[model samples]
Target chain A: MKASDGQLIGYEKEGSELWLWDDLPELHMEAGYRIDRLLHYERSPYQEISVAETAAFGRMLVLDGVPQVTEKDGYIYNEMITHLAMVTHPHPRHVAMIGGGDCGPAREAAKYTEVERIDVVEIDARVSEVCRLWLNRDPSERADSLTHLHHADGAKWIRKPPVPIDVLLIDRSDPYGPSAALYTKAFYKSVYDSLSADGITVFQSGSPFFDMKGLRITTQRLRSLFPVVRTYWTAIPSFPGGMWSFTLASKGTDPLLGCMDRLPTDTRYVNKAIIPAAFELPNFIQSALD
Target chain B: MKASDGQLIGYEKEGSELWLWDDLPELHMEAGYRIDRLLHYERSPYQEISVAETAAFGRMLVLDGVPQVTEKDGYIYNEMITHLAMVTHPHPRHVAMIGGGDCGPAREAAKYTEVERIDVVEIDARVSEVCRLWLNRDPSERADSLTHLHHADGAKWIRKPPVPIDVLLIDRSDPYGPSAALYTKAFYKSVYDSLSADGITVFQSGSPFFDMKGLRITTQRLRSLFPVVRTYWTAIPSFPGGMWSFTLASKGTDPLLGCMDRLPTDTRYVNKAIIPAAFELPNFIQSALD
Candidate 1:
């Protein structure tokens, strides 16, 4: 029996869905999605990347055994990760995205009327090609206007001038691999130097439950460089902690002071209500970040 | 290979971790916890009752095969479900609790210095005793000061009077079988008539993702009776939806106008930051309730 056959809905075989991350043995944890099939799997020069067409979440891009983005919930991540900082900075024109290989952040930033240029610096060009060819669907139905794909090391590349970015979106992978440099204070200083005087940078902070040290260290690193720093979260069921934290580091403008009563572009999730609301942390998580 | 040999942790065999609900098989989903052991299993006059001691979640009370409460994250649900309404009311003295046989709501309500008494009306007495003898560890360290458990049907019992309750916590099971009447429009009217002039009531609304129909009906029912009704959500990773919703209905005062700066007692999760944040729903969910 299968769900497609409409035979009372719950008759699919267990082995039909086979994407589970059994990597985190310490917490006795694993999480993955129910996909239609594995679409593309290959080793890029940087990392192992796999794309899938999920049954519930549409297309998904998995890198190194963890899900980077899924079509269904990508808007929640991409919109909040981009718009939270973009809207906070008074006039964010030239936005820089570090390690957004999937082009999700690029597509979102391009939606904003205020954003003139978006430089998405992904280490692996193959991830962007895979997404462009397979996973990139017009989720919000916005015209992909101005997102320049740059294949280079983001840590060193952002040091050079590129229009003095007003807002930077760090959509990097976790802090354990080649992406580790992006989490350092020096890297944050480099990002600070690349931004305008009133610039803001947003990035996905690690889950506090499973990656408390990473979250603590990341927040500390950002706080040392930026004047105003805060942590917010979003929920995607297939993730390890179910709650994913995002940090906004600004020079003077605070994202919590997000009062752009109306967005310049359309979004599925991010709104004025969600801006300050997202910063509310659970007590345990608040303690972990402390 | 085990976590229990003179160790601070407890470990059990992989076989001990079972009972994934294959009932909702169409989504190809299941969720279960690693158990220390199945402590109790039997059928009450109403429905099935089973208890288990879990590795990650401490003791779990699963009624009719759905988890009622888990020790690890029970306080998160217990506190949010109780305090959100309790704090909103001007002076919550006499409170009412329905269907919380695990005494989670009663325990949390007893923490309030302003709450002199709480009348807990539950149909099943056996469920209360089972938890009292086994699972009620007082995670919040509040003395069992003023929660009186009444063994009576809540739907009919709440229709009667108990000094005109100030705050009501309806911690019923899912909106099905025995617990279905509590979600009806008429039952909501009964609750409305039972409350004080400035009273507020709160209940666990169904998940918008899996049980949208129930969420819709619950919100509709609450809206028809109360002047103000709002839906808020919390995340308990082990639950069915990973996200759970609660509805707060007030006679004239709005729960959304919550501005209680502090609490009278200690808590691990709920704080002033979480109140307004919890009420901020995602766009799709806000549309569902609309």
Candidate 2:
């Protein structure tokens, strides 16, 4: 494609060649990746799911045309989303993950031996099936004996959780379509009721640059529902903005004092020093939260 | 553009409509922004420079098709690249910036009342001329009394002493073309020689995701020269990968012990809490540094 100056600016997708493009329409920006091979494609009751292999990020899972996770950088998101709350709670025994059909968060939670049961409520069972086949290549890597996969609506399931969740992780997509209800105050109140006294819940808050309003609203909602609320960020290249934020709402436990030293050494993103560091917001972001 | 499945993927550059496209060819990924109006375009002795106004980012300055600064988000990069080192140094009076032709680093340095002199050595006089007109809209905002703009090759200029630089900032583009020599060990040694006994120098390393090798090598080269070298990062949505890294090398002071409490209150991105927070590297990045 040629720019206005007739300068050869960008490459054009050739006919019959597969390429995945993600658009941040609100920000007037877009990112494109070349797909080497299409591994899986299906239209579930919820959203369109596709798995493609690319040289840059290996196998990538896309939901509703949005790149969800990739073999290369998925660990960063999974670890950041799970480990913070997991380590924060003194003794996280019962864990629950909502809408994480890909099982990436479940995989990270399973690393802790003390966790007896993990209930993953995903509305679409097809995502779990496809990801198991392509993304999660090693079934043995996950603790099958402890993890319970329930293909139920997370919003409904969270209203009456089977167990009191010590570390509740909401891994839903953007607040749109079926996931819109999951981001509401009512759903957050349900999450608050379903957790233990010292329980902590962490969920993706959206990109700070593109969705600061969403982030601010999420923080405000979480603050109203929980005693302690903290917003942290992590970098995931596949995400619309490489920097993605997450809000941790707890009944009692302080996220900044999380037992990061106990963080599994296998993690690629979260470490002891980075846990508190993530909570430190830049001046602009802090102003938004204020 | 259409995907292989006949899906409309991305917007096509229309006739006479300007769009800036930045390609990270090595990563097989690209990001594009819609330009509203073209303000200036020039081919100086160094490289291609263009300034345009965009709806999302307002006015943007592009050097060789790469977006350097935008009216909206330029503060993040300027504050991050400048404040970390500026705050780290105990009493930064004389500062030298190499290749920050846009006068951003100098403007940031001028924020400090103690900073008596700031010498900006830029190779392209056209960059300063264009940015002075478009990006740096307020000339009086800059402490012109304490600032000096020199149009010269930074590599050659740094070889000779230009007063004892308490804080040296290299705000050049990526390590290619005319900026290649600035990344060499010899130039870094020249920088080391020109600093005060307790001087601090910080420069943009690269994007951690797209340029890990480059970041690693830069950190290594700086470690070879300075007694204290620390790597930190900040997020800039317009920049490729959104997350950008910087390396700080000091003669005596520790970056983590920077006087962050004295950070300018008017700044947008940098704050006391974020100073130490920025120094915290994720496990994956720490592994790269190790």
Candidate 3:
């Protein structure tokens, strides 16, 4: 159930049914919206479903009323992940996104003026199928030319060899049950090893309130690996706990350390005035980081 | 129902029987192992009997699930209002709060250290009664001695004569139903008249997301009356809307123009490190402000 905005609102599902709700509007989208997209259902970790195509513009996945990912607001999160890193880096031509099966981040990666190639490593092929069938009506025509989708375990791919990646975006979920290994230090260091000298990597942590200890530990571990590591927070109306946090790690210059007056004029949520503002963590987060 | 940590999770009243839920575990109190207190009922806002007590002290106004005021967290908003002006001012001693009946803002006034005398003009006697009975069990035990709690309609009190209020805190509710007159320009001009040279006054506008038009009108009116007026926003978790906005106006010396360094200790939310962070309005607010 969502408490805040439609942008980052939470939704949950059971078996073939998918449901989403917000505070102002009691019930938003529901099972009727899910148009024959159920590929697989598993109750081992938690009641989660792998869906194919939905009547809604986006691919739907729900676990206990929490919307895992959707194609509509995917651009907001994807753009935030890819653009923030790409723009900060001096020249990030080669980029890698981990666990973003939907390829939304890859699509956003192609938008960067400086980026040449984008690689997406996702484990779930069903997610890619949903994206291709529903999310991207004309996938081949609309997607960025520089995009390359890979079906593989993101952590395993990063663990081994790779021609030095420039920007790596870890868009994985919580580090519990299914997504546990993804949050380990070994995977993060592998990610650090895969990046170029002046490379930057941005990873979606979890809600600062609910996932306090997780956020703190992951940020601390990433800080140990990278020269400059910082946590940035934002409020997405759809996300659980109403607030979300991200960890940015870089081997090159600390992007946040120095002020850069020049910024690309095409921004919706971010601007020159709020560059530093985004990095300003709450008291609870500050205490956790300390 | 309330969330954990002794926050006023939610409130519901059926007839004279009011239901209060504390999201957290049982709180410790001198009276006994305490639960949530029934602040008021729908039948009468003034008629409230404290059914419980707790060690965690603060003002609690439970109206249809929303806790309007609490003592512990009240300082955050009050400090934000009082300090945002006081620090920007060359000398701000004489202060007044328009509708802070709970005396929480008045209590925060005592913490300013700089201010010589503070007056709290409240329209309702029941608000003070509730605060004293349910929230602040011992009101006369504060360290500061210069606060004057006046029981009078703030709007009527401001119209009679200019009291030269250096820092005025307008802690009224939404402008639609009960608090309609408080949002008018006439009251704002009276507030302007009451302020000394370069004096500052901060007032709660409304939810930027839901009430953007209202926020714009209030801010525009404040700007017309004052030479320097800027809108500052802060996120209150328990508010009706997820994000809340405040308007900070001054006769001179734009509050946003200066750097905030000095601050009173014992602050859980605001500090020197995240001072600029408070002014970072959300995208919806920025759009409305623009």
Number of the top lDDT candidate? 2
TM-score of chain A of each: 0.87, 0.92, 0.76
Residue B171's lDDT in candidate 1: 86
Encode model 3's per-residue lDDT on A1-290: one tens digit a residue: 12122222233353555433322221111122333344433332333434433444245554433456655345446556665676677777888888766777776666556777778886666666655655564343324577777777788888763568888999987565446678887888888888888888998987675557878888888988888888887655334423567888988867675333434454455565566676777566787798
lDDT of 3 by residue, B154-209 (tens): 78887763368788889886554345678877898888888888788888887665
lDDT of 1 by residue, B139-200 (tens): 43443557677888888998886689999888888667678878777788899899999999
The TM-scores of all predictions, comma-separated, are 0.85, 0.93, 0.76
Supply fnat for every model shown. Answer: 0.33, 0.72, 0.13
Candidate scoring better on TM-score of 1 and 2: 2
**lDDT of candidate 1 at residue B243, scale 0 to 100:** 61
Please state the CAPRI-style docking class of candidate 3.
incorrect
Docking class of 2: medium
Candidate whose DockQ is highest:
2
Interface RMSD of each: 2.5, 1.4, 12.1
Q: Which candidate is the best by TM-score?
A: 2
Tell me the number of clashing residue pairs for each predicted model.
Answer: 3, 0, 20
